[model samples]
Target: MKKTWKRLNLIAAACGILVMSAGQAQAMGLLQAYEAALINDPTYRAAVSENTAGKEFRNIGRSGLLPTLQYVYGSGKNRAEITQPATNFLGQPTGGFAVSNYDYTSITNSLSLRQVLFSLDATARYKQGIAQTNYSDAIFSARSKDLVIRLTTAYADVKFAEDQLDLYHAQRDALDEQRRINARMFEKGEGTKTDMLETQAKLDVAEAQVIEAQDNLLNARNAFSAIVGSEVTQLDGLRAEFTVMPAKQTSFEEWMTVATENNPEIAAAKYSLEAAELEISKAKAGHTPRLDLNAGYNRGLSDSITTRTQDQTIKSIGVQLVIPIYAGGYVNAISAQAVANRDKARADLDSTRNRIAIELRRQFNALQTSLTKISALQKSVNSSTLLVEATKQSVKGGVRINLDVLSSEQQLVAAKRDLAQAKYNYLISFLKLRVAAGTISIDDIQTVAAYFSPMS
Candidate 1:
């Protein structure tokens, strides 16, 4: 019984520690989400691994230009038999035959070195390696930027879902109150049956909407957790008076120029094209002569026929030249393929540029439209609030029915929701436009984060 109590105490302490750890994980913000995603996002991690492996291409290409050394050793036992018609010293064949048999062991050792004296293919490959490394770097940069956008968008989605759920709850509560009032009024024989039925129907619809909103919130939270690799019970909300500003560069042409120069996709495509060109050169180099410096030292023991012990050492150094005469059109075919690949790369680059241009314009226009819509919606929210009050006063004066007040309240809530959404869209479009212009950085995220306050 004492031992059981001790074990229970240990388990209780462990549970306390876990609770404390969970409590320490504060509500996540935009920048915090970005930081977590850097370590946790699978797509970004894959890019990091790929970039690390790609760095080896340089060393692989350089190996052809460096000297290589090798040591070789061999041991074997051999048996030989010889038969010959004997010849006399006077150069006349004797009428006799001789036969001999011998068994012997032999050992040999050698050290060899070779260095490329000249090779066009090796040079081209070295250049290609440099280009490939550049391409990898550009691709990693693109992925990093993509991660930032993805995290930010996901964070916004969670916020939007939460807001929608809150709005739905408020709407449901208002309808429930109205339904209760209608029920009491009908019991007193002061309200029509049709009016009570309509109120109950609206209440039921509101309840269904609340459930739908809850499910949406749950899904959004799940997506958020998937990116940050942790459950998020709460997140910071946008400040009440968050401001949206126009992009610094208003001219589309200027933004286009910047995108062309700085976009990682474009840079990667350019590097790929360079590598393809180098591949063509590498293939064409197949027809060129290759020169290599070779040197070796060798030692051998034993004579095969005499079974006599012998030792010899040989040392030699020379240059080897290989001129490719023919290869059944393989070289030409490969060269043609490389040229075609280069053309494809060029086309891809053009396509990427055009796509970026379209994206920039689209995001830019969306941002401009959001700014206008936000301004207009702000006024609409204010006007709707006044209308709700006026309708309530009219109901007190017996000039309007309860339904009119309820309709005004619904309009106010819808207007507020729309305004909130417009603000989020504006911020997102601002970030996306910068991304399209290749100017988005951590500063942008920080700026956006400044507009949010931690949940209380």
Candidate 2:
């Protein structure tokens, strides 16, 4: 009964693995991974949060354009101040006392509003905030683009590894059958020892490759799950596709132009510069005077039981001027810092443009090379298969050695693997191009989905 139970457990485990594989088939794909990242990726969430904070900054500057209001209401006993008195006419020091004291409590309340008459710095600062918000939005979009590329790369790696595993397994299975057939021939005394030994050697090699392929699959899945913010117990098999052709005639200068105009980092740097300029303007305005307008009206009575009589309401309007004076050089230092930051931002913009151009060219070259490689690798795989078959027949006919047949088969397997890697590289390079161009957003998902949809 115990032995039977052990066999039953083995069957159950196999069934579980098959079920899990089926579930994985319906799990999220590369596009879904990217979508999950938008909400689940910690880095992306932080960028979005920072962008939200930037939006609030614009409201702060709105105060300069809108009216400022305050409500004031108060009632207190008016007590005259008394200080030390000098000698009176009698040559004796007079006692310090309140000279005249009367009930002087009045209820005063008002809502005073002040609007800016002229403020250049305030307007500039607001524009700067607007620019900052726009810049953060661009950053968030760029981050999303980067995340998509990452997901694509990771997803592709797992699929590539899986394809390799399949190839290895197939090769191993073929060797297993060869070994069985050779063993049967040896039992019948029709096969030489050399043939059976070579078959056994190949079986060993095939088993080793299977183990290696499995390890690669495990590593690839681990990486994929890490990036997608979820555990990947199994991976769905995918076809080798999703490659795009590079432009036949792409000029470096044109690429640079596009990057400078459309790269989010460049736009963000420009916005940072604009924000710094606004800061300088604000600091410069620190030396200027400000005019404040105010008004108020009050109607409230004191709650003293002894004096139940109510106080009359009072209202007042006035204008006030604020003149700037020496301020410990703080404002000057801020203006200098702003100027320095603006210079740095300009340099960053230039540097970012250079980097973007370089990346575009790199991805373009990689994609082109991979395309050619995939084509060549396909031919090699076909040619290698023919060679392997011919060599196998020749070896069986005693025209070739067993080692030669094994070597040819190994070469064929290697060709298939190389082709798989080249295909994976091609897809990765294509994704890099989209990311470099700053176009890998939800729009990329839509485009990919459209391409994958039924041709009918």
Query: lDDT for each of the candidates?
Result: 0.83, 0.69
Candidate 2 lDDT, 23-57, residue by residue in tens: 34335555455545555567766876887887876
Worst 10 residues of 1 by lDDT: 1-10
The alpha-carbon lDDT assigned to residue 431 of candidate 1 equals 84
Clashing residue pairs in all predictions, respectively, total 0, 2
Which portions of model 2 show Cα errors greater than 4 Å? 1-26, 72-110, 163-216, 233-249, 303-310, 391-409, 439-456
Cα lDDT tens digits, model 1, 11-130, are 535543343346334477776676666656788779989989888788888888899999999988888888888789996789888788878888889999999999999999999998
Q: lDDT score of model 2? A: 0.69
Candidates in order, TM-scores: namely: 0.84, 0.72
